[model samples]
Each structure stands twice: as structure tokens, then as C-alpha cells.
Target chain A: MHSIDFIVLFGTLLAIALYGTWKTRKSHDLKGYLLGDNSMKWGTIGLSVMATQASAITFLSTPGQAYQDGMGFVQFYFGMPIAMIILSAVVVPLYFKLKVYTAYEFLEQRFDLKSRALAAFLFLVSRGLAAGITIYAPAIILTAILNWDINITILIIGVLVIIYTVSGGTKAVAETQKQQMVVIMAGMFVAFVVLLVKLPDHIGFKESLVVAGKMGKMNVIDWKFDPTNRYNIWSGLTAALFLFLAYFGTDQSQVQRYLSGKSIKEIRLGLLFNGVFKIPMQFSILLIGVLVFIFYQFTMPPIFFNKTETDKLATSKYEQQYNELSKQHQQVFDQKRVLLGELVAADKAGDEESTTQLTERVNKLQEQQESIKAEAVGLMQDINPDLDSKDSDYVFITFVMKYLPHGIIGLLMAVIFSAAMSSTSSELNALGSTTVIDFYKRMVNDSATDAHYLFMSRLFTVFWGILALLFAVFATQLDNLIQAVNILGSVFYGPILGIFIVAFGVKYVKANAVFVATVISEGIIVWLYFLSRAGKLGITYLWFNPIGALLVVAIAVVLQAVWPKKTT
Target chain B: MLKNDSFMDFLKTPEYTEAPVLGNWKAFYLTSIIFFVVELLLFSYLTIAY
Candidate 1:
């Protein structure tokens, strides 16, 4: 990035963090530190809930996804509103009824202390690593674009979030999140309009969608019953429902957002507000990606988006071969754009056979582009033999740096950093709260006063922030932040949601049945995960949430009936 | 001045409600239908028209 861009981006983030710390410096007790003193309105709660969930991955990788795939990935959230409704009517009230600090706290009241500890342990492990990935998301980029050390970037961003979060606690997180959401939305909107303006005049927005549509990027809904299809209606509805429940219901990051509300009704209103807005927000972001894909159609893009490897090739003997390949790659872009124009004209003229032929030819040219990219990656590996070649994560950033103008580019860059901070800050804040209220204060030192717990909460926040920084330094080893968060959620969200479903929905299921069933269910789910990854099972990873939840609930119910206990 | 209150009474336990379970279900369904209509309209414009 140029000097001006860097100034605007980092300056905005630092200013917001400083503002948050100043705004809520008086949170001197446990309730204020952990739960924001139960004084937030539905608007702050609503925006915080959305901001907490909207990670840097949502900004960076999702548009890249839309550029490649269209708008269908949004089906994954079809279950969210249903899940939200269930939470608003059921889960929110139960959490409020128990007057708990963390969602896992209720598991002990309704079941046993072991259940609470188990749930909290699951949350810490899942959210802690996720916090690391969130930190990694934008840090990886700042290091890449700024040509700085990746570890330095990670530490810089990590400390920025930790300082305010540790000092001001939950109020700091919510207040900063509110401002961050405003910047995030405004930046993204400007980026979207800028991307649109950068497109060619003749190939307007409608024509661009037609080209994307012809490429089969607009498949928004798939009613097919295939378990392997990741974003189809069935996987999205049932499996996504359980995943949402586990995430928004049992997960502390989300649960704590609403748990800070002053009343159950406000909590419901806040959650339901999110339910209504989230899917469309995601769809809009993905739509921006799809538009970016079309923007690259007329324009020539990098053969390999991962500049780190591309830089390595610049010094190697293979640089000559990479240059030759780039010439061919440019030719492929010329051919693809020519074919897309013909395809648009053919469809406009109502020529069925010509349209089909144009689509086929266009797809073949697209494949040629992919093959050239594959060749570039292969050449890069030959240049350094140990380089990571999967560059899907770098696609969007490469586009922005190459195509966008200066000021807007900086704002979009700020959007991504904001997303990373929002998600990472929430994760650190949640991890600290859980560790203090659910574990340290609850188990080790139950007699501590509010001020003492508040201190511990801030202490743990700083500790987790450092840990997440370490995680970010190693994040480049992973493919992308978006995939990282989903993969992490798929691992633990299922079994945790299963226990809660039994607790709330099936009241008679014995604790022993649940405890035993969770272990067995998790084992089987792991087996299924391996099978699917090995291509042995046909089920997609999205289906794992429902499958795991159903397995535990079904088995526990059967087990509870078999070993009936006397009424309490 | 900041006024903070612990919301102990906000928990709507099943027994705390005056309405019957079936009535609550009806209210839920009604709320859901309203949500569906609003969402359907919102996305239809946000997608096709935008």
C-alpha cells in the first residue's frame, strides 16, 4: 500500500480503539466488565451481534467466492432465522431465566456442573483457535501488501485489540463494535460502487450478471436431496439449523451479545433483528464478489494471485517460463472476454444454438485460464520446491490492489482490518469472560468478590490476545480464514448443540444419558468427518451439524428410556 | 450518570406466562409468517433489482 492508504487505514482502527477505551473506562465491576452492565438497547445489541459474527473472512474470501460461484452459498443461512426464532422464543428466555454470565452456566443448573464445565471447555477450545484465525485473516494481508514481516503484522493488530478490550471489557467491545460496523458497512458500500464504476460501459450491471449467470454462478437455490452438495436446501435447513443453534445458542461469543440485554424481550428483538438482516447482508457481500468476478472478465488479472510465491519466482530460473506462461494467460483472458461478449449478444438475439455454443466455448477458455494458473503454481513450486500454492485466499486482495483507485482502496482495506478486529476482539473478550466466570471464578475461587473477578477478566483478555497473536503468525499455513472458521465450528458446534437440544427440547433425558451419548456421538461424527474428507461418505461438511445433533439426541432419548430413574 | 440494573425478572419461564402453550405456538407461527414475508420481499429486491 502507498503511504496515504496506510495512514487512513491504521489511523481509523487506532482511533476507534482509543475511543472505545475512553467511552467505557468506568466499567469497574464484574457485571459491567463481562455483561456491559445490562444497559444496552436492542440496536447496540443487534449491531454487535452482527458485527461479532461478521469476521474478516466475510469481507475478504466471500467476495472471492461470489466471483467464482455466484450467490448460492447464502442458502447456508436459510436455517438461521428459524434457529433465531427458536432462540428468541425458547433459548433467550431460558438464559435470562437462569440469570447466567455464560451460556454454559445454564447447563449446570439444568443438568450438572460437569455438563457446564464440559460445554465451557468446548467453547474455549473452539473460540480460542477461531480468535487466532480471525487475527490471522487481515494480518496475513497487511504483511503481504505492506511487504512487512507476517509476525510483526500479527503482533501489531493483536495488541491494538487487546489494549482496549482488556482495559474497558464488554462495554469496550460493544461500543467499538458499533463504530466498527458503521465503518465496515460504509467502506463496503463504497467498494461495491467503485467496483461497479470500474466495469466497462457496454457490459453494464445486467450484462455482467448475465455473463455470470451463463457461467452458472447464479445458482441461488438447489432443492436436490444430495447430501454431498454443500449449500443445498436440505443441508442448509436441517444441518444449518443445528449449526446455528450451536453457534448463536450455545456459543458464548453470540450468546453473550444478547445476554447483555436488559430484558428478555429486548434480547429477542435484537436476535430476531439479526435473523432478518444477516442472510441479505451475506448475499450482498457475495454479490459484490460476483460483480468483481465479472470486472476481472474484461480485465487481465494475475496468473497466480498469491504474490508471495510470485515474488519467489521473480528471482528463480523459472521466471522466464513464468513470463511465457503470463503471455499465454493474457491471451486466454482476451479469448474469454471475446467469447463472453458473443454469448451475451447471442442470448440477446434469441439464438438458442448459438447461445449454447458460446457458453461451451467460453467455459473451455475459462478452463484454459485455470490450466495456466495451475502451470504457474507448478512453476513456482519448481522455483522453490517448498512453497504453498493454494492462492484462493489472495484472489480478492490482488484484485483490489491492482484495480481499485487510491482512497477507496484504503477504505476497503480498512473494512477487512475492521472485520478481523471485530471478530478477533469478540473472540478474545468471550474467551476471557468464559475463563473467568465459567472456570476460574466459578471453580477455583468461588468466593471472590465482583472487583476481583473483573480484574481476572481483564487479565485473561490480555492473555488470550497474546495467544491469538501467536496463532495469527502461523495462520499462513492454513488455506483461508473463511474456511478456517467454518472448519473449526464443524468440529465442536455439533456435540455442544446436541446437549442443549436435549436439555431444552427433551426435558426427560437423563444427564447420564446425555453425558454418555455426547462422547459416543462425537466419536461417530469424527468417523463421519474422516469418511467425507476421504471421499468415502457422500455427506457434505455442512450436514455434519444436524447429523451430529440428531445422533446424540436420538441415542440419548433411547438410552434414557432404557434406564429410567425415579422422579426428582 | 449511568443507571445499571440486573435483569433478574426478565426470564420468561414457561410457568410465568399467562397464555397457553398452544396460543404461544400460534403466536410463534404468526411471527414466523410475518418474518418470511418481510425477508422474501427484502431479498427479492436486494438480489434481482439491485
Candidate 2:
């Protein structure tokens, strides 16, 4: 909020946007505009792919997830490396050989016009709405924690992304993302080091880890196979594999990232780069949360991370009750702080029996603290019945705003804004290209000049950008923006991936069978998702990916056998 | 089905080039898988040891 911080944030963002627009200002041809003239190397393509996926929510809410649920969420990405390798080996070369502008174009050559349109329509519907959340998620949290106006925050992010992406097209998106990734990683690493330094002199890094682990914050892997459990090895390896495959292999936003590569070799290497480094990047972010948890053990964190809710509670009729709870919460924290010190000492001195005893006592006190906080949250809900009760999304930003230095605060804000722009730019760029290439050129105006198509691509980019901004302004009732986006993706990605899988693997299944099967499979998946949401079904969201895809494949096979298409 | 249209023929087209640093695409993929396995092992250790 300081002038210096504002300067740093805006200066960094404007510099990158201007640089990208100026660098690619000469783009005129449709191919050059849509595909970056195929000039990107593996490094730019790799970082662009990473940036498209790591939205503002990844940096803003992931640490909060770690703070609340521990590191088990890392399991969500366990399938990423395998998915990347599969894409590199099988999908990349075929795409290059086909020389398609959009991933759905290959579907038309393999199947028929209707199939391509169906897949492209599915992508536009799912990704269009998701682009809204990409901007809104960080804007909501940043504005709440920083006390900025929400509409201005949203416009700042959406308009800047639209400016660069509409100006330079894919080349601008890719070029700006390179600088954004540098800022994102540097800001996170600096925050990590600061979190370490902020710890008490007596509690070294090892002691901090010991405190966090015994307190159950270091849970990185869950080998259990429970289907309903969201984060486990089984779900990550099997179900998330389908999700990742659909996301990277079939989605236009990601497909366009690698499609801009100079050659098949460049694209494959780009994907492989993401494959090798994605997990480690995620691991470091989660570790920062664990460090924050340990830091809070020595210092008192807010009774509730979201001060906006608590601020309302201050004037409510239950103010006395909340005050009593806050007092009780402070006492519990004070008690646990002493016990955590003893627990760490016992572990350091190799006294296992004393360590176990101290751990139980400290955990009990921690539970008391949580119960008081939960009561406060209940009061907040009573006051405002429609308020989202999950405060985990506010945890990391609260820490950054309160504890981080001023200049660093600006840099971290830039980090969030950079992430927002990097991802939204890619989404708009892809949405525009898909509209022009897959629908407009193919259907509405097949004989247009190259200049006209290029102009339309830029026009559609702005069109989608405005639509995403309008959606962000209205996206206020969603619960846990990250999960909402992923759930939306899982609902549609399966059938799209299914159509592609059949196109590549099953030569016997014709266009009619696959198309009809996909329609039915999507209907089934959406129904199943609602059933699970209502607790009638016990399946997790990740299961939707494999379930929908397999349903399409199976139904297509059955339909093909029952009513075979006549060869003309 | 036509021979050129088969997925196997696409695989046999020899369009892929050598991977950067690793020289062979197979070697690069193998190394990537190996790196993934090591990460899993490291995470498991973090789960147990800490």
C-alpha cells in the first residue's frame, strides 16, 4: 500500500507489458499472430506452459492449503511428470506433422467436421469461464487483505493482460511470461528465505521442521487408496493422470503454448522441462507454508486469517462471545508455544519417550486453539449467512501483508499480478485463436484474406477478455476458487480427451459413434458430479476424468458394433 | 485402413531428433522417469523422517 510498493508493482508490470508489445509489434500474418511465427525455443515454450498452468491461485492459495491441510496436496501433481512424458513422446510429433493451428483441427481430419466443432465448443465453454476465476481469485484475496477496491483490482489485472495479448498475440503472451516467471520464482524464493530468517534464534531450521512434523504439518505423501479421499497416491497417479493428459494434450491454452515451438524437438523438450521441474517448484512453495506455520508457533497468528470476517464480528451481537473465544485462543497459543519448545528439545536430545508425551500435550493445546477459532467462524456465518467460511485462501496473503517488508510487499504483489497476467493472456490468446481458426475460418468465412483473419483473431481476443472481466465481477458466490476451477475442468476435460484418444487409437470407431458417445458421456459425467456433490455418490472429482473418458470409449465401441457405419 | 494412416506408420516416420544434452530421446525420457522416481522417494522420506 505504500507509494514505494505501488511504484515497484506498476513499474514491473508496465515494463514487461510494453516490452512484449513492442517486441512483437510487427506481427501481421495469421500464422505469425496465432502461433508466434513458430519462433519460440524450448525454454520459452516450457516457461510459457508452466505460467499458463500456475495461475494467481497457485501462488496465492497453495501455501494456504499447506497451512491448513499439510503437504498431502502435493500428491495432486504426482501424475504431472508422467503426463508430460507421454505428451512429449506421443502427442507432440503427431501435432507437428499435422501442422494444425488448434488441437481440434486434427480431430476434423481424423473424424469429421461435427466432431471437431464439439471438441472446440467444449474447450471454449470450460476455459472461457475459468479465465474469469484466474483473474478474480487473486483480485478478491489481494483486495481483501490490502484494503483496495475490488472492481479497480479486477480491471487492473484484466485490462493489462488484454493489452499485451491483443497487441502481440501468442508471441507477446510467451515473451511476457518469460519475465513473469522470473519475477514469480524470485519473489517466492525471497519470501522463503525471509520466512527462515524470521524464525526465533533458538529454533533453527531443523527444530522448525521437527515442530511442524510433530504438529502434523509435514504430511507430504498419503499412500492410502481410499477413493473418496481427494489427496492420495492412488488418486494422484491414476485419476490425476487423466486430468493432466486432458489438460496438456487436448486443451487449447496448453496446446498453443507448445504449438508455438520451433520444431517437434523444441516442443518435446519444452514439455519434458516442465515434467522434470514442476514437482520441485510445488514442493518449495509448500515448504514455505510449513515454515510459516512454525514461525506462528513462536508468534501469535490472527485468531482467524480472514480479518474481513472478524472485522464484521467486532460489531455483531455476539461480540462478547467472540472476545471470550479470542482470549481463550491466545491462552491456548501461549500454552502450546511452551510445550512445542519442550517437544523440540526432547527430540533434539534423543529422548523419544519425553518427546512423545510433549507432542501429545502440544497437539491437544493446538486443538483447543482450533476449536475457539471454529466457534468464531460459526459466529461469522451466523452474522452473514452467505459468507464463504473457508479462510485458508487468506492465510498466505495475510502473512505477506503483515510480516513482509514494504518493498518486498510490492514485489510479491507484482508476483501475483504477473501470474494473473501471464495466465489470462494465454487464455485470451488461445480463446481468440480457437474462435478464429476452429469456428470462424472453418464455418463463417472460409475465403477471407490473411489480413482479415489476423484482424479477427485480435478482435476475438479482446472479446473474450471483456467477457472474462464481466464474469469475474459476478463470480462472488464460489467456494474455494481453486477447487471450483478444477472441478469445472474435470467435468469437461474427460470427454474431450476421450474424443482425441479415439481419434488417435481407435481406427474402427467412426465419427458418428464417437460424437454421439461423447455427448452421452458428458451428460453422464455432469450428472455424476452433481450426485457426488449431493453425497449420493462417494466418488472424488479426480475420478471424473478417467470415468468420462472410458465411458466415451466404451459407448463408442458398443455403438460402432451395434450400428456399423457403411464405407462409402 | 490405409498404411500411411495407421498410428504405427506415424511412429515409424523418424521425425523426432536428438534430445538436448541427453543425445538420445529414449535416454532423455528414461532420465526424466528416473528423476520422478527419486522425487517420490524423497517425498516419502519427508513423510517418514520428519
A407: Cα error in model 1, Å: 1.9
> Candidate 1 residues A16-106, lDDT tens each?
9999999998999888888899888888898999999998878877887777677878888888888888888767766775668898887
Task: In candidate 1, list every pair of residues with a backbone clash.
Answer: none
Where does candidate 2 chain A have its weakest 10-residue lDDT segment? A477-486
Candidate 2: the clashing residue pairs are: none
Model 1 — interface RMS deviation? 9.5
Q: What's the CA error at residue A135 for candidate 2, in Å?
A: 1.0
TM-score of each: 0.91, 0.96
Model 2 spans > 4 angstroms off: A477-487, A566-568, B1-23
Q: What is the C-alpha DockQ of each candidate?
A: 0.11, 0.38
Error of 1 at A446 (Å): 1.3
User: Model 1, stretches more than 4 Å misplaced?
Assistant: A351-353, A384-389, A474-488, A566-568, B1-15, B18-50
